[model samples]
Target: MTSTGSTIEPPTTRAMVGASVDQPDAGIARRRWMSVLKHAGLIALSVVMVYPLIWLVVSSFKPNEKIFSDLSIFTGDLTFENYLHGWTSQQLPFSVFLVNSSILVLGAIVGNLISCSLAAYAFARLRFWGRNAFFAIMLGTIMLPFHVVLVPQFVIFRELGWLETFLPLIVPKFLAADAFFIFLMVQFIRGLPKEIFEAARIDGAGQFRIYSQITLPLMVPALATTAIFTFIWTWGDFFGPLIYLRTRENFPVSIALKGFVDAQSSSDYGAMFAMSVVSLIPLFLAFLIGQRYLIKGFATTGIK
Candidate 1:
């Protein structure tokens, strides 16, 4: 429609403007739907992953006869006797294994934190001879399967008189034997600004001082990641404890869990499940506490 000799433009222009505005709203709506779908998939995957753990806890409360027989996690027959017997039936109380595991985990955490951080600091900050080659070798070790060196390592530990002791499990950690943690830390340390180290040195700070005061603080997320992983791995470690720990009294919670299985006659499935559930608590707590740092590092330090 025209007014006078010229066309009135507002209605057509308003229609175009409204169309343009609605375009973005449609795009946003599409994106929202996509986001919802993605989250739904993730939630489903999370439930799938957590299902076994849920089943484990639920099964712990169930009777042994009903453990495998009842496919459903929600069982009617529940008892605390499993926990009581599992805790006390062992030659020593369940507390002994818990205490043993605690000691091993504590030692490993301390060792890895001190050793891996130092190694990372050296690789990231302090430059010396053969640094690249050493770093390359350290990384190469990660590719080597643990089983390849398992026997040799065991023999070395045995020769060192570390058999039948926690040393076999704990000592290598203090020496930065786990290349994964070192690599993790090195990456995190590298992501830190070099200027901090320069400034620290400019202020007459020594290497140790710079490391302790500056890098350590800035590396909290990485360090926390290291500590959390170390605690979990050490706490759940069965191989090292199984190989070195000769007696039930010295066995960690992981090794102690085996005591419930008796092939000759009967296996205490209910009791075993109960103790396994109990064993998971410390790891859950540690992960819950340190998960923030793990997420922070993952977000900030991307393949760096």
Candidate 2:
């Protein structure tokens, strides 16, 4: 009894509804597959990156003869003898080397934070006569390699009676010798909204006051980034310590670790690896503590 047009409408409406449902489900399934593949690739890369550190840790605990024989991290039997031997057999007390390294790293961090932040602020916010010219010169210095200036630096330190002392390692940081760190801070500062500084100025705040009260509070992340880099670099520096530290007593952990390399005998791979692992602990802890600051800084600063 239904009309012909009415009879055709029901089937047409059902077909359209079925097609719409199928299209979205199919699209969602494809997107979910793509996401799974992306995550799988990332997991594989992470595993690859972490494998070597695992191997190193495993090899450190392996016996000298078995270290090279077994590449599997979990298969190796663990031993603490290598660590004990490494700790006890050094000419320079390992503890003293640890202290020396800590001192140098701390001094460098403090120096870089103060000097670099000040320089960056000047470069970012000031209106001095030769500000642009000075910044250009500073940028130009970044091109010069550390090796090119090493001998000159050595001679200057020697003339100043700073050779064979921590001064050679720590003094250059006070001079804003780290052009890259300064540049990083400058870029980060530039990315901040100009209105913040303007508002502070209008409220009768001086430049120094603004820097200490406002800029510094906002710059926690950048400061942490600079501090972490300074600490790691100062801690791991071998050549500078090798050149400046003549006495075994003055040797940092980096220099003392080199003593493990025997000129005529087979090197103790197990002990060396154990010491290397031990050396990594402080730097690892440092990064863990400061990582939040670094993440927050990058997020807020909008610096690339």
TM-scores, all candidates, are: 0.83, 0.83
Displacement of residue 279 (Cα, Å) in model 2 is 0.9
When summed lDDT is taken over every stretch of 10 residues in candidate 1, the lowest stretch is: 1-10
List clash counts for every candidate, in order.
0, 0
Model 2 bad stretches (over 4 Å): 1-34, 262-266, 293-304
Model 1 segments beyond 4 Å from truth?
A: 1-43, 262-264, 296-304
Residue 77's lDDT in candidate 2: 76
The lDDT per prediction is: 0.83, 0.83
lDDT of 1 by residue, 218-295 (tens): 988788887887888889888888888979889898888777764315577888889988999998898788888766
The true-versus-predicted C-alpha distance at residue 114 of model 2, in Å, is: 1.0
Error of 2 at 38 (Å): 3.7
